[model samples]
Target: MMTNAIIPLVYGLLIGKSNDDYNQFFEKLFEQDNFQPESIMTDYEGGTIKSVKEMLPNVLHKAVWRQVQSKGLATKYREDESFRLKVKKLIALAFLPVDDITTAFDLIVDEFDEEADDLLEYFGKTWIGEPKRRGTGRKKPPSDHKL
Candidate 1:
């Protein structure tokens, strides 16, 4: 079961062994009364990201990452000018702290334009690093491709 919460106002239980299971869980939550939420912050799990995008299309989804000691592999890549810049931009986008999506995007743009290297590095080390994947293997494809 995957649980998501927003303090006193909102909390959700997403019971599932697979992506479809959680998708159904979220669908039911949306149907239920008193379940509206402004935004959701979650670990950078790909399935959760896809489910949130499909189910809560209107809600703000922020990917959260915890600080961890780096293996210095990222630093090795830092020597490559283009790769460093790309990583810096992505890291900035991933780490900007804001209450909502708009502010987060704004911060990312501002930092990117200003070339805030320190901020980008801090974000890279803490939040913008590679995400960990959880759960089982991929789901079976739907019979029809066209919607």
Candidate 2:
């Protein structure tokens, strides 16, 4: 996402099932006209994280809790009054103009440190190259997958 100089802009949510699939998606994103962002905030997906670090090392990265809140199971923060109020505050904080995107991210990170830490720890344990069994050689049909 492109943003005015006063605020950070974020774009795209291309999820993939494998590292190669994720790489191809990011390649497409990079091909869009001058789509280089100064920073990107994303969920802690291993393939995406690896791709971003390797492909855009200079960009700032901030991991957000919304990613975890939305994964696997449905999240009900939207239905709870206090949670809704907290989300409203976060949204307002996110949109406030800052000197740069980094500052904006720092604000976000600071505001949600507990949630962010939980997400980071979860990511570190789940996605960072821990050993796993390779399944049988049957490949799933493309139509059956979304990522």
Candidate 3:
């Protein structure tokens, strides 16, 4: 899998970090080397995710542990083994069958305490839509499991 591969194909300064910047970078990479990786990984950057989906629609997009840092859970992930495990469990939810993610997410979130409320809310809003102020069941999720 691309995740386990040893590859660092590019390193340079970016004028900015935006959907436009990433899009142009990817376009140039393709123009120069005709490069199109099987997959790309990111730290939960919205611009990167948007560009990857736009330019490399056929390629897989994966998120690494940097999600912890992005969500301000770095200290908790490092010091609290239980929270770390729960976070890993949440990440693991990505590998589950798409139809099964909601159930698995609910199961993992059940173990979270108030410390994880914001993280849970982040996940709920980003990957799975939260319940409405008034609803019988969950709203249709905003992000697909692929995210």
Candidate scoring better on TM-score of 1 and 3: 3
Considering only N, C-alpha and C atoms within 3 Å, which residue pairs clash in candidate 3? Answer: none
Clashing pairs in 1: none
What is the C-alpha local distance difference test score of each model? 0.47, 0.48, 0.72
lDDT tens per residue, model 2, 28-101? 88888998875676666767766776667545334324444644211534455554444344433323443342
Report the Cα lDDT for candidate 2: 0.48
Distance from true location, Cα of 89 in model 2, Å: 35
State the lDDT at 13 in candidate 2: 61
How many residue pairs clash (N, CA or C atoms closer than 3 angstroms) in each of the candidate models, in the order given?
A: 0, 1, 0
TM-score of 1: 0.34
C-alpha positional error of residue 121 in candidate 3 after TM-score superposition, expressed in Å? 0.0
Candidate 1, residues 51-145, lDDT tens digits: the string is: 76667654532322121114233443446565445444453442333334234433554534333455444543444332234663222222211
* lDDT: worst 10-residue window of model 1: 138-147
* Deviation in Å, model 2, residue 7 alpha carbon: 8.4
Q: Of models 2 and 3, which has the larger lDDT?
A: 3
lDDT of 3 by residue, 14-65 (tens): 7888889988888888887567686566656777877876777555224434
